[model samples]
Target: MTKPSLQILAVTLCFALPAGAASLSDPFATEAVTPPRPSPQAAGRSAGVPCAREIPAAPLTAIDAVDLTLCNNPQTREIWAAARYQAAQVGVAQAAWLPNLDGRLGSSRLWSEQRNYNSTSAALTLSWLVFDSGARSASGESARQLLAAAVATQDATVQSLFLSALQSFYTAQAARAAVASTTEAERAAREGFSAAESRYEVGIATPADRLLAQTALSQATLNRIRVEGEARNALGALASVMGFRAGQPIELAAPPAGQPDAAFAQDVAALIAEAEARRPDLKAAEAQVRAAEAGVDLARAQGRPTITVSAAPTWAEVDRVSANGGVVGVTVNLPLFTGFDTTYRVRAAEAQVDLRAAQRDSLRNQVALDVWRAYQSLTTATQSLRTTLDLVASAEQSERVALGRYKAGVGNVLDLLTAQSALAAARLQRIQAALDWYVFRATLAQAVGALDYSLLEPAAQGRP
Candidate 1:
């Protein structure tokens, strides 16, 4: 009787089990436990990517394409070329310390009586700055400073060009992403339209629903077309920046993968410090200050004595005749005070020094402000990228659920369409967020006035 009662109880428990319970002969339970879906990316992709890098891009190397474009740009090249010329001027100023030699050759014929003489003269005049106080020395120093400033200006030009190139590269890549995004949206919309038509045929969905889906499909298709066109334009712009013809293929070289992360928290201050240390423009201003000091010295030296020596020798020769004569002399002009010319020049030089010093201080403040702003931008972009990535993941999961529901006839056409639209928006947002982080990183580099050559590709090297 006890065994029979236990068997009846076991049978009763088995019969009372819910149909969908995990333990009750459920085949789909294992399938439902499958892993989470992947994030919307070119299979095996990750978040906050510095930029989508291709193998073709790796060959560009940091030095080749970028360096050459900045250095070799016909318009930009002039800045460096002019810098060379300014440096040469330093040599000219140094020349004052050396003697000058002039050679002359001439023949003169006279028609007057005994006093008139036919003559030919050949001579060299030599003059050296024996002393003009410190004017020569001051001028030489000023010229050297000017050359340094010019070189700094050239550096700034190169930096500016590289920043522009980076902008173009990122812009084109963004457009590329946009085209892909829009194309997928169009495909999703068409699928939605098809789904809507099938539902309407079964008398479940309204005709208006099918029409709405079709309209969305048309709009998505148009948007894709526009985005594709924009991609072409962006590519052209990138090519042009590379010193290539518009419409040329701008092979984007992958920069070393950088991500906007909390790593910036501690490093942002350091970046600001780098801007001060590495920025060439600051050095240029400092050079001007030194140049101004030299100018002051130059002015103060005005009344000082400057000794110059000159000599000329002459002779008369007849082509077929006999008599000849010659004369030789040395001349020197000592500085004579002319209404205190030196004193006024000294005053002017003092004024210039004050003005230039003020300008240098102002520039320093401006640079500091720029550094601060760039740091903030980098931080903000980094945060935004993280948020967008999370959103994409959520949207992807939602999209999968919707797909499953619609196929099972439990979800309506509207649910499927909305889910698809949301997924597209999420994907695009993520793409844009990734691009923003990269662009802000480039901006941060530019603000600091220094660039890591290692991060650049080979295609960017060699401006000369």
Candidate 2:
């Protein structure tokens, strides 16, 4: 109720309320937005944005599969949370530039032989660091660089998941194609069996020929069954990767049907250079090096001098007598000695810088090698596509001719069965080659840090 008490109460209500409100409101809270991409080209690929999303009941395309996996998979969420945590650290670093305030209140009672009295006191203190030899700046820079690293790491993780979804989708498609090939082989074998039975009934084919045709039909049927099972297993694996139960059913649209683009034959050296420049993992490593450099600066600054300003106001009411006072001062601190702790800290921070630099260089080399390997794989897959196309065509023709010859009684059943088997094998090879082409194309894009929805366009090589 006194003047000093009123003043202390006013300051407490004024400054303390805002600080309390800030604590409750969370000024550093991040929005539930999509993780930032390393490049603008990836913006169109709307994956990894956590929201209420449902997988389409209809068949999924390659792009759909990737989007679902990124949105639903835990890997993306974990990396995103890490980046957000780093963002909060940036806020913490920025806070070092601001002033701090504290308030204290105390009450005590005394009882003696001849006197009894109650005492009450209140005080408010404010401190602001005016200079710290650039320590705050160095700390803020380190935190910001770490945040950059975290963001780039998130982009790298998203690209990895994108490639994984593509690989699984393509594998499932290949398995389905294999099943179709086996079914066709089974049909061809059945036709051959029918022809053999007809020939044996008319005394034009031996019992051995009839027996061989029946055996070939049964083998084809068995292969068809096995391929169907494989296709189912492949679908289950894909479902699991998409954050669904392993047994969940997922229908996939017919894959793109064309061979990979010839433009992928670009110079390998140029591609490697592009990857080093654009790869998110490389960027992340480079950021870590810069952060380590900032850490060295922070360590050195910690051993320097600091200048701070402080203010305190006090109020007291004891034995019905009130008093008020205020104090303001500036202080300087010089770290003259710390048992050689600063010396070791500076050395450790400098060593960390060296370690980060070496790691960054190592990662840069790995990026180049990754691009080279992916390029070579895609090239090999492309060449195999041509051979597989020719192989399937020739095998189909041979099987037809052999079947015609056997039906006309000019060839043994052995020739017909062998040709049919060759055609079946050729079909499987073609399917596998197509799958490899799709996978390698995506792999090359991922290696170059450009995996996105554009790669899955209808006109791109993703079809088939």
TM-score winner: 2
lDDT of 1: 0.66
TM-score of each: 0.76, 0.88
| Quality of model 2 by C-alpha lDDT | 0.83
Model 1, 1-464: lDDT tens digits are 13443354345445444346454334214223221221112112223233222223444432344544553456465775577567656756755665554556778777656566666655434444466768899998898888788777766766776667667777777788888888988887887788778878897778887887888799889989998999899877766766767765555544445443434434566766777788888888889989999999988776666665443333335543543333333444456766878788888889989988999889888788887887787677678788887888898788778767765668876777778788888888877877677666666766788644423433322110
TM-score of 1: 0.76
Q: Considering only N, C-alpha and C atoms within 3 Å, which residue pairs clash in candidate 2?
A: 255-464, 256-463, 256-464, 257-463, 257-464
Count of clashing pairs, candidate 2: 5
Candidate 1 steric clashes:
24
Clashes of each: 24, 5
Off by over 4 Å in 2: 1-42, 46-52, 194-215, 257-260, 459-464
What are the runs in model 1 whose C-alpha is more than 4 Å off?
1-68, 112-117, 251-262, 265-267, 317-344, 406-409, 412-415, 456-464
